[model samples]
Target: MAIYHFEAKMISRGTGRSVVAAAAYASCSKIYNDYDGMMHDYTRKHGCVYSEIFLPSNAPPEWQDRTELWNAVEAAEKAKDSRLARELIVALPVEIGLDEWKAILKDFISKQCVNKGMCADVSIHDTDGHNPHAHILLTMRPIDDKGKWQAKTQKEYLCKRGDEERGFTAAEFKTAQADGWEKQYQYKVDKKKLYMTPTEAEQQGYERVSKNPKSTRYGRQNPICAEWNSEEQVLRWRKAWEGVTNKALEQNSIDARVDCRSFKECGIDEQPTIHEGVSAHIIEQRGGVSERCEMNRQIKADNALLLEIKKQIKKLSAIVVDKVKKTVLDFANTLENLRNRYIFNRYEITQNENISTELKQYNTTIDVTVQRYNGIVQQLDNKITELKKMKAEQKHLNPIHIFRHKELTEHIDKTEKEIKKLQNLKSAFLDKMSCKSEKDIPQY
Candidate 1:
């Protein structure tokens, strides 16, 4: 089965990573970093089946070269802790052969990344062929219409206008400068540092000291770049990839479908498994299964059991909630038809005995139905009891069967609620029947 996996990360200088090196490692090639005089060589690394670079319309045509593109990205950011690039690691459907991987990935990346104006370098790896996946290296900054790297953040200064202090970018401040807006600076006042405008400092008998103006933390991120960095955008990208991959899987006549959401988000009650990363993959590739793989297998087995339990509950719901309820309502309507005829004084004395006989028959039928529903409830109760007993015995064991016990508890609670709903619905039908007891008003 093809599983869903999409992870977003940054190639950041703060983490001591260079985008140029990341590009080389992902593409399985040799590239030299112009920023730090380091050569990243992954020429002999295994399992890179394909690599390609995609560029936007406004981007330089020469940026199609992976090394040149990333080196330019490194050169653009002049900070020690700069975020170099955005990277997405996504799993490809293994059922699709290597021959068709490129077209699917090209459509996916072009729609999700490159069209958003980020230069994307895509690389697919399938060393063991079963774990086929791709690494998407994307530039952080956007290229302008002139093919130059746009500023990730423009300088914004804090300006004072009357009692209001607001921030303006370099371009906005140009016009804002004529509107009684003065830049604020740190002023020395009675051995304390105070931030005020030059006029305010003079009026307060203070001296301006600091030449550097205050700015917002993280400055002002480029709108496009900031949108790309948002959680919603990442989620959108994941969903987009899932849609594309599932389409390919369907085209190949594969039986499996993938979802991008977590188990909880997908409304699944099963616990999710842990990610078995590089070391585990290496072990499995060498024909030795790792402990994590064993754990995942166990998890899959537990999930299958939980799904079976859910299916049984769904069947019960279909019977009690839909079929049984609808039949009861139909019976109620039929009883109401007779009552309506009697209510409007349309029944003659000759028909009174016949109507009474019919009412008695309806009472007997309702009783039988109520009894049948009671039986169903009893059966559900018995199942819950068995589950609880199993849960208790498992809890007493050394390992305690943690997952099963928890699911069983939830199952028990859900069943009890369903039983409550069944009881209430039965009472509602009995309320409309009007002669629920045999001892009182039975021969009416």
Candidate 2:
């Protein structure tokens, strides 16, 4: 079966992470970082079936090498806390072959990254047969037409013209300076610090305390790079992954499809289960249980019980007999509080299709049994009504006939009472499951 998973994060120097080491691990090879003068090697690390570097048209051809590409990224950033790379990991559908997925991934990266002037270093991993995913490391900076690394951001100086203040870059300042725009600086006026033009401050007899002109904090980011780092872009990538994977599944004639929407977004109240990675899955398969697996199991069981209760409630409206209604009311009276019916446990909801299907079948069987019991009760009631009419109409019935009728009616009523008790027991079983307790369940 194919699964849907798309995770994205950043490798930043602010978090003490290195893109060189990240690239080495993803490619399953050795690479040296020129910026830190350190060699990052992951030759011993397993499960990187494929790895490659993709460059923009104007990017240097030498950057096709992982070491060269990532080293250039490291060398370009002068800040100790610069964002080094964008990392994304997506699960590959089993319906598609490794080579086919690679081609699909290449198309995604080419259109979304390389064509937009960013380089991509991608690797596919399948150490465990169950979980196959790809890792992508993308360059944070864009390349110019001359194949030179462009600045991620540029300084925008604050200037005032008349009473209006605006930020302008170096090129824009040249034109704006001609229109009587003056750079603003921090000035000491009496005992307070104020921002004013040099000429204005001098005329007011204020001292220019700071040499630095006021500018926007962190400067103005390049528009393209800014859009790439926005939250909206990540959402787009997630949706795109879902679309491509579904297309592949459909082409392969596989009925199973994946969704990017979360449980809440889909309006489902069931809690989703957490991903139990390769290690947790292996432990459970080797005669041992993992904490994640156990939590998932519990969540599945609770969800199953909740579904059963919902179905039983829906079927209740179909039953109109007075005996059925009275039995349900009596069962409801047994519970002191209805708030204990739901249990909220940790972990996401697992996709236990088999368990869900079997529960539905079991509920269907119970409905059939209840319907049969109702039919028998209805027949007994009709028989008793006929017997009373015959007893009143007859002048003097045979003594044997009167005795036999009395005995037969008594047996019919007894059978009806037994059937009503069974129906009551079924309702109690549903309540027991909903509360996740054995207290209300009958031993019989």
For all predicted structures, in order, the TM-scores are 0.65, 0.71
Residue 427 miss distance in model 1 (angstroms) = 89
- Tens-digit lDDT string for candidate 2 (251-355): 788899999999999999787888787698788898765667876777676677667666656766677787687758744653322324432332133334445
Q: Please name the candidate that would achieve the greatest lDDT relative to the true structure.
A: 1
- Model 2 misplacement above 4 A: 205-207, 278-295, 323-444
C-alpha RMSD of each candidate structure in angstroms: 24.9, 29.5
Residue 105 in candidate 2, Cα distance off native in Å: 0.6
lDDT of 1: 0.81
lDDT per model, in order?
0.81, 0.80
Candidate 1 error regions (>4 Å): 283-444
What is the lDDT for 383 in model 1?
Answer: 61
